[model samples]
Target chain A: MTVAIQLGIIVGYLLLALAIGLVAYRLTDRTAEDFYLASRTVGTIVLLFTTFATLLSAFTFFAGPNVAYEQGPEWVLVMGLMDGIIFAILWYVIGYKQWLLGRQYEYVTLGEMLGDRFASRRLRGLVAGVSLLWLFPYVMLQQVGAGTALQALTEGTVPYAVGAGLITAFMILYVVVAGFRGIAWTDTLQGAFMLVTTWIALVWVLAVVGGPSAASSALEAEAAHHLALGSDFYTVQWMLSTAITIGFGVAMFPQVNQRFFAAGSKKVLKRSFALWPLLCVLLFVPSFLLGAWARGLDVAIPEGENVLPVILAEYTPVWFAALVIAGAMAAMMSSSDSMLLSGSSYFTRDLYRPFVDTDLSARREDLLARIGVVGFATASFLASLWNPATLFELGDAAFSGFAQLALPVMVALYWRKTTRAGITAGILASQVFYLSSLFTSIVPSTYAGWTAGLVGMGLGLVVTVAVSLLTTPAPDERRAIYFDGLEAD
Target chain B: MSRPALWGWIAVAIGLSALTIPWFLWGDATLVAGVPLWLWWHVGWMGLASLVFWLFARRFWGLGIESDSDSSGGSPGSGSRVDAGGERR
Candidate 1:
């Protein structure tokens, strides 16, 4: 009976999400921007929540608590405190410039602006390709979260394969029916539910297992290491590198970049970012703490990502557990749908139209983008079947991949002297070094305490600067398109 | 310096320090509010970041005050007034 209630809530939530998509479809127009970016018409509240929901992926909802449950409360510093601030600054730095340039160029994708600025179509295609390589795994991370959650929630009755398939189908339907507008609305709804339920779960768990003071005392007595931050893994270097990689990686995410274009105005973007840290506080604090608290309550988390469901099922009531599970689903779906949408946009705009179908019309472009959404989601669904890695491991790999792009993209955006050759060389050097570390043993995963991704970013920056000085400059007209503003340092 | 530009640099300065400063050097034994001093220290910086970004947005980016008036027609290389500063006047 309890399982039935929980499954019913999840199905009902999915139906509600579908209904919102249908409504958004009715409101949507046939233009490319309308389909892809909500015609750049998102307002402040929706903008804020959608960005919030999208960034707070299943990694946070599931893996975060699991990390806390296994490692200690120190995960809070990595997941909550550092990321809140780091990502906020990144959004401020990256979003402001991207929004300004996006407005001026009517750019629907990051590649469009970067390519046009350098007058290099290959640069455009490379950016999209790099995004796809990293983003595919991240999308699979969401599928992995959903499947794991259902398998655990229903005690393996549903199975991971069924869970993955269900989410992919719903996400494809949502994006195809409503596009960007539907995504924004459903994200807002799901984002709110996620925040509220997370807090409720935290409070309920704390109350069930004794309050913070009692829980902390119990933790200290039984597992003192969980309360402290100087463990072998939580060293000064690892914490800082984790924060830096996740922070900068978040800024370069294509889905996040697209949000900058969708904002109705600078006010909407600014307001959203301004409140971002507080949002992080509300969500991450309770979520991670609950995971840590589970230790005091003697909850057995067989798998780290299963921490949320494990705790709620053992301690909380049936109906409340259902709501919290639904929220976790919301976190996964909200993130997954946006990623699918962004991936399709990248493929259609950067690769297909430019290379495959040079004369593709707006109508065909829209159709192709929708097809790309299904394709990307299907690929990720299959990828999730391997159950490749733990949620945190998958998220970390994806975050590191995107972080390497941050340096090149930042340099290209602000520095007019950044040539097409320079940016390309920087990205190539970064990816080669970074990938070599992950795949081979050419460089130790952590060399002299810095992560491979950080090393790649550092090398990429150096190579870009060196190559730009060596290469012929982009024409003055191309430079002016990106830099012709009244501000100077 | 423009109000926003000054705050922009300040934001970056604070941000770099928050990420770079060795908070983990603090001993894990000292707990504040049930969290280790090192963790609490980072939380303090998170609060500081929120304040810094709010200031940057209001004074530097001119968030609420600035609106994209020519959004529909402001394609780059065209004659629209939209520029990197994000101001029309």
Candidate 2:
């Protein structure tokens, strides 16, 4: 496959996605519900695939192989498989509760859930602010991945800026015109391509490396540290940290929360949750195996990051190579669309409507959301042009900040007596702690900074709960406003 | 509180986490594709977790089990309006 053919295939895929979005637009009214949640009509299958696609982005596809290459076998043990289990548990324990609440309230975004639960406009605003901030870096990561793919497949024929711009332009147009409905429908298609690409690459890589049995034997005979799990203590600590970061952080991600709200019903959400893990195997497992096999083949590449995909492109036939390239592109675009859509929704529904103009009509709000989507996509695309030195590090830092939301948001959901003062204090405390840890020398590393942030959040929650109980309770009517229609009988 | 359900989920989660941990795969095994069987244990654990989640969602949270009441229309105490009077009544 020449660079020209690869570019053509990617361009075709983008056009097909845009057409799907346009079709969805014609089928549904351009109202807030339709723009935000596809009128909450997403069935179990669409929801399931979209959720899976959104979660497993270019980061998983590109970085999983790199991590496996560097960390030896422990990468799969500590990060790969453990992360999946964490997601499952998170879905069962926290996500189910969120789904039930989202259905009950018809929540549009995560900020709405926080505001309604804690009864604090400021807290809601704070959440919206954080969401918008974190989404920029995340969207930038996808753009960088897209740039990498274009550069690799084109053999540097196209410049990085041009590649990123084209991808971002296509995404912005599709999203602004179609909204969540457009993104979800396109994700369903992209998700299918990703699964097929992954399976094919896995089998082809294994065959080239002389099958799984031969590959394993070759790896075992390597240097002493080849298959070792590294330091036991470090491995356990890394695994635990990775699990917590991904489990709680991913659950709190604005895009994932948006998906929770988009499900047509609790049943749809739950069924989707059940089916997503199966899809994850097809998406994740093969990358680890392929990366390990590449290492055994002694493909000398750049250390840390550039090893896995480069090896694949170097070793595999042009046709299979094109498929892998397509898969990587699929991963990047699927995630980028969801992030752009979620960020735009936060800006329109959470930030703009309530604070800027409480009386903005539904029609005006929908228009504003479309405009916001374009603006955010443009800004994120510009940011992606910087081509940050460390994509995974930036992602980890952003997720750590997102994790700070867990305590305040969770308490507000289940704790009826949560006070506004506590919620505000909690958000401030967590943000301050996280920002300080991030910028200063206080925390030694990313994990430590996350620990400090979690501690601050914990303390803030204690104060919020304690003070609310001691202070005069919010008016019963006010409490009932949140409880709305739930029955006690 | 549903202790059985809660504890069951906790136990299963812990068991799955343990399965992914490399302690069980400590013994020397032939490496396949430059990865030991122990390493593949992690993949197996993830696969199982995914399977369990799928099953739980299908069996317990499916739309088929839900009551098909027409609750889309506003119900009593829908609370769309914050207050009836000019005051916060």
* Whole-model lDDT per candidate: 0.78, 0.68
Top-DockQ candidate index? 1
**Predicted model with the maximum lDDT:** 1
Query: TM-score of every model?
Result: 0.91, 0.87
Q: Which window of 10 residues has the lowest lDDT sum in candidate 1 chain B?
A: B73-82
| DockQ of every predicted complex | 0.23, 0.22
Over A416-441, each residue of candidate 2 has an lDDT whose tens digit, in order, gives 67777666666677777777877889
Q: How accurate is candidate 1 locally (lDDT)?
A: 0.78
- Model 2, residue B19: what's the lDDT? 68
* Model 1: residue A246 alpha-carbon error in angstroms: 1.2
